[model samples]
Target: MTRNATSFPFDIVLFDLDGTLVDSNRDLAPAVNHALSLEDRPPVPEAEVRNLIGGGAFAMLERALQATGGPVAQTRFAELGAELLAHYRAHIADNTVPFEGVTAALDRLAQLGCKLAVCTNKAEEPARDLLAKLDLAGRFDAIYGGDTLGPGNAKPDPAMLYAAIADCGGGRAAMVGDSTYDVRAARNANIPAITFRYGYHDVPVEELGGDAMIDHWNELLPTLEGVLTS
Candidate 1:
């Protein structure tokens, strides 16, 4: 792989938004609790909500409902899910913010001319809205949500990752995310992956199967550089 001012081994960097870039638990936890309250169920703890994320809104709600013994029917979940999405959108950035050093790290990557994109389990519109709210939307060349490629092409399937690479001009790429969905998708795509330690991982970060694990945004560039050689 050649390394130069305008050339690098990887031309694109795909990121998973929720856990990898932003900590959305503050807003997500309350929204799910509110949705649960609508069904007269007890509120699930914030920590539990954090664990349920990375799969998308519906999956999060499903797990929350299951935890509270609420109805899990197709219709019932849809009805409550609508409420949850609405609540989330209404207060998307109430407490959501990019993790420490995220903006600076993104700036560094952009300066290096690496095309950046987001592949998240969140819905397209909400993802855009949230990123815009946080002033991070303009930084990405593309953003694909769980529903962006239909219901079956989300993370852990590699469809979205493939789409992201193609959409970003189809070059050498790497994935940066926080959970199994991210790592598994990277594996399916046959791309190197780096897991961030501060994100919302259901299990252990070491077990997520990333090519590398980074504890802070400052380490991302070096990790990506290493991936290029190895």
Candidate 2:
């Protein structure tokens, strides 16, 4: 994509994977339930499973287990997490899809000369796989996942955002996500954050503390312009 004559305020725009770019609960909930079934736990309704997302696979599994019954032993938890990932990978895009207006919005950003990158808490391989399967991978300059920077470097930790900005040839940037991890990471990195109100946030969208909140993809560019310019 060619840059327009008028420069976009932010050089790079980083996005979160699960809830920000796509509504992945259809496949994610089932994967969580699949792991729960191993412990004979009842399935969490897909709607409820939406609330369990955002942190990462293991964190999602932990929330699912806690909601169904209680926590499991670490070893068992690891095993269940493996099961969840296995099931998810096999059916990754079975029902997963981007939110309304996502493609158009991305195209608009590209036209505006904004380099896009995904800064997600999902593992690097699956994050790439999901985007590639959806044909959205090529739009991004980079994809940084929870495992991308090694242990203890996921969002709410700023490292991934910093890395993504640098990898995309650093300049002023903003994070667009659906959860606290995204907002907090942007704050930690001293950048602006624009959050989606319809994402998988556990708390009220107002409580997310993003620089700006958007209810739909159509609002993204204007919101980003507002946030960056104001």
Candidate 3:
């Protein structure tokens, strides 16, 4: 793939997992449906499930419940959460695969001496499991999940992004993601953010307020450099 020869500008490139690095909607959507099925609720369509993602599995399931009908039964929320997680863990990568050009882009970034890491709302173990399955686990200097820093530490909170930067030895950092959660996290952390246009964004990618936007992984380096300089 073509690439920019400009010098790298950031110390770290932190990526959001689902919809950003990998397309796991096939598996994720099913997991949501499975949880709903257990509660005898009608299965939400996969297209709708994509929008419900990004806030983590609990949020996805909660949204599914709400989108299908009404408020989730508080008594079964935890049980359904556990069930969803278990189902997802068992079929983590059934249809999941890295987005086009992801590996090549990662290699290019690594060659530029940019530390790579992941900060995602997916729970840590499943995130690790999926990456390992795709052989991309070794690519990240650090991998942080929603549960990594305990409650409320996930993206949109900035804790995970901060942790990813710190884990990668700290320097200039920028975030890449496909949703508001990622951009909000980067903004809250006072860092630049780049949004991927092809991911599962619930709204217009422009509204996410990224420092820059990339429609393909091959554009990542140039976009990151542009974000840094601007």
Candidate 4:
């Protein structure tokens, strides 16, 4: 298919915020532990919390509740979310770090004139704060989180992905994320999705059926190379 006049031959890139860009659980892990501790529920492992992150704060909490074999009470979940949010809000940047080579990849995309933005399942305030804290806030033309877009929607729905593409101002764009949610979101939007090997999918990478997969952030440049060159 011919590229659209305004469509990117490789112009716009929409990135997932969690496992794709930064490991956010330094805030997430301790916050969950604190809340569970308050209820006498055993603390969730940091690794599990890390795996649980891409879906959003409440989703992670729900997973934790299941892990603990609880009644899945909303009141308890709300209590936990409040505590976790309080702590996480205070230390948003403490343990956050960009994946190796992320800056270099983004810099290359920038130099190539690829418009960039972040579309994340994380809520708006935290997604924006994390971007600013990581110093990656300026790279994207737009940012969208679950709360920022309005109620009752998120990834796998394509609304957030389309919003980012529109904000970047007319270009073919792809979704980069760690889970099936990303793939489904991209398909729903009629855009392509790329899965990262390093992120938090509960299943193995090959099962994802994305346009491409990468184990390292730097591989992106050459992956794009293969596409634009071919």
Candidate with top TM-score is 2
Q: After superposition on all CA atoms, what RMSD does each candidate show versus the true structure? A: 2.0, 2.0, 3.5, 2.7
If the candidates were sorted by their lDDT against the true structure, best first, what order would they fall in?
2, 1, 3, 4
TM-score of every prediction relative to native:
0.93, 0.96, 0.93, 0.91
Weakest 10 consecutive residues of candidate 4 by summed lDDT: 1-10
> Which pairs of residues collide in model 3?
none
User: Model 1 — which ten-residue stretch has the worst lDDT?
Assistant: 1-10
Q: What is the lDDT of candidate 3?
A: 0.87
Backbone clash total for model 2 is: 0
Candidate 4: pairs in clash:
8-172
The residue-by-residue lDDT of candidate 4 on 1-230, one tens digit each, is: 32343333576788888888887776788987887788788988888787666568778777777787664567867878888788888888999898899999998787777888888888988889989988999888899997777876688778988888877776667677888878888889988777789887745667877788989997887776575336
By TM-score, rank the candidates, best first: 2, 3, 1, 4
- Supply candidate 3's per-residue lDDT for 101: 96
Whole-model Cα lDDT of every candidate shown, in order: 0.88, 0.91, 0.87, 0.79
Off by over 4 Å in 4: 1-8, 227-230
The model with the greater lDDT, 2 or 4, is 2
- Candidate that scores best on lDDT: 2
